[model samples]
Structures are given as structure tokens and as C-alpha cells.
Target: MSLRYFDNLLKSLYTVARMNEPAKPDWEKIAAMPEFQALLKAKRRFVVPCCIFFTIYYFSLLYLVGWHTEMVKKVVLGHLNIAYLFALSQFFMAWIIAFLYTKKSSKFDQQAAAFLDHAGFKK
Candidate 1:
């Protein structure tokens, strides 16, 4: 066996080892990036208001059901009462919120991908 052969084998092994290991992003550096900060701010701007609105809307239903029983019990449709309609509206509300978030997150993801590229991180 030649010394050059052993050196080549070692090099091949090192290369294989590196290829098997996934590249790790530097969280601290990523966090420090202005692009990342802007992404977070943008997400916060959307998410905070959605969360606040959803919470208030949800609690208001509970409040109406618990305290304003007469109001909620009033018939709005042939069979559906205000409470039932309100409860049903929650499902639609959740779906709407989810749809909005999904739509918004795609933009966020694009921004994040750009951020990663700018930061020299592999996707």
C-alpha cells in the first residue's frame, strides 16, 4: 500500500463525513440580522391583531351565552338561534384566520428564504 493511497483514503473519508452532516445555521447571527428582525416585526404586526380580534370575538360569544342568555336565545332563522349562529360563525372565523395566516406565511417564507440567502445560510 502506498502512503499516497492512505492519504487519499483519509481525504475521501473526511469528505464523506462532512457530506453526511447537515449544515447548522448560526442562530445568534440569524437573530442579529436586520432582515430577520424585519420579518419578525412584520409577522408580529399581523399576528398580534389577529390574535387580539380572535380572542375578543371568542370571549364575547362566551359572555353572550353565559350572561346574555335571552339575547343569544332569540331566534334569527327558522330553527337557528343567535347562539347557534354565533357558534357556527366561530368555525368560519377560525377558517378565515387560518386562510389569512397561510397566505401571509407564504410571503414570510419568501422573506425568510431571502434572509437565509443574505445571511449565507443553506436552506
Candidate 2:
């Protein structure tokens, strides 16, 4: 059989399986769970600081380029100027944050699994 045919077959099987599964938990029940609350708190702790830092860091570049054009144009190394370097640094900063978030998200997944188990729900 073709790959596309197998893919469609699998999708139909998945839909059938989903239809047979138990109902999802209510949102209120999930919200009341201590483990779920801890998950939210943990996520906030990691996410809020990263967001604030990224916003300030990104905007500072714009502010400097717009208001302090001469400072931004000054050569930092070889022919590369401060603006070029700062803009380049943004790419690295984004990659670093994504890496960190990926690592942290695994922990969040674990927490979510534990919460599911605690709630007597099968994954």
C-alpha cells in the first residue's frame, strides 16, 4: 500500500480509539489539584523572567539605535559595529532561551504526568 493510504488508515483508527476513550477531566477539577497548581507556579517562575528579560533586551537595542545612533555605530571589533554585534547577540540569546525552555518543559511534562496519575487519569 502507498504511504498516504497507510497514513489515512492510521488516522481513522486513531479517531475510532479516541471516540472509545473515557471523558476528559473537568477544568475545575484540574484547577483544584495541588499538583496542577504547582505546575502553573513552576511555569510562571521560569516564563515570566524570561519574557521580561527578552522584552527589555530587545527594546534596549531599538532604543540605543534610535536615540544613541553614534554609540551604536561605533566600531566594536574589526569592522563590526555595536549595532551589528548587538543584533547578532539577539539570535544567540533567543537560541539560549529556547534551549533552556526545552529543558525546563521536560520537567513540566513530568509534573503534568504526575498530576494525571494523581487524578486517576490514564495517559
Candidate 3:
């Protein structure tokens, strides 16, 4: 019974999360070129650190939620009633991080796109 429910949940997630535009990485072209390769390396460096930061940030929230749920009274705010400022801070930080990532990724992607165009690749 639980297995069937879990399978349906996974299917629902797959359906909703399906990509509208799939990523098309040009690794072959990037690998052949020197500057494009450096751009790839720089992009990776920027991305990996941001990923790690968010990963740790979220993991700490999970840990804190588990640790603090015992002390905070769960209250209803419309639908969710998790009444805790600590939890709210986590959510706020998540939004701030998301905004930062969008800005950062745009900058990096723009730089990378320029480099790729200069390397004889189409945008």
C-alpha cells in the first residue's frame, strides 16, 4: 500500500518537474577551445561553491527544525502553522539565496555566452 503511494508521488513529481527547455551543453566544442574551456572552468567554480553553500544552508535548517520543533508552538499561518522564527529565517534566507543565484548565474552565463560566441559558436 505504502509502496504504491510512494510510486504515485514520484510519478507526480516527475510530471510537474519536467523541463520546458532542456539544457544543451556543447561539451565537444567547449573542450576543443582554450577560452571556452576556461569559461567552463570559471562557471563550474562559481556554480559549485554556490551549490555547496545552499546545500549546507538547507541542511542546517533541517537540523535546526528537528532540533527546535520541540520548543516552538506550531501555529497556523493560512495553511502552514509552523510557528517558529528560526524556521522563518531559513525560508527568508532561501529566498535571498535564490535571488542571489539568479543574478549570479545570469552574469556568468552572459560572460560564458560571449566567450562561446567569440569562439565561433552560435547563441
Measured on C-alpha atoms, candidate 3 has an lDDT of 0.73
Considering lDDT, which of the candidate structures 1 and 3 is the better prediction for this target?
1
TM-score of each model, paired residue for residue: 0.75, 0.78, 0.53
lDDT of 2 by residue, 28-97 (tens): 9778899999999999999999999999999999999999999999997999999999999999999999
> Ranking under TM-score, best-scoring first?
2, 1, 3
**Residue-wise C-alpha lDDT for candidate 3, range 29-78, written one tens digit per residue:** 76768776777787788778877887887777677567876544566565
Which regions of candidate 3 are displaced past 4 Å? 1-29, 67-83
lDDT of each: 0.95, 0.96, 0.73
Q: Worst lDDT window (10 residues) for model 2?
A: 22-31
Q: How big is the positional error of residue 84 in model 1, measured in Å on the Cα after superposition?
A: 0.5
Superposition-based RMSD of candidate 2 using all C-alpha atoms, in angstroms: 8.3
**Candidate with the larger TM-score of 1 and 3:** 1
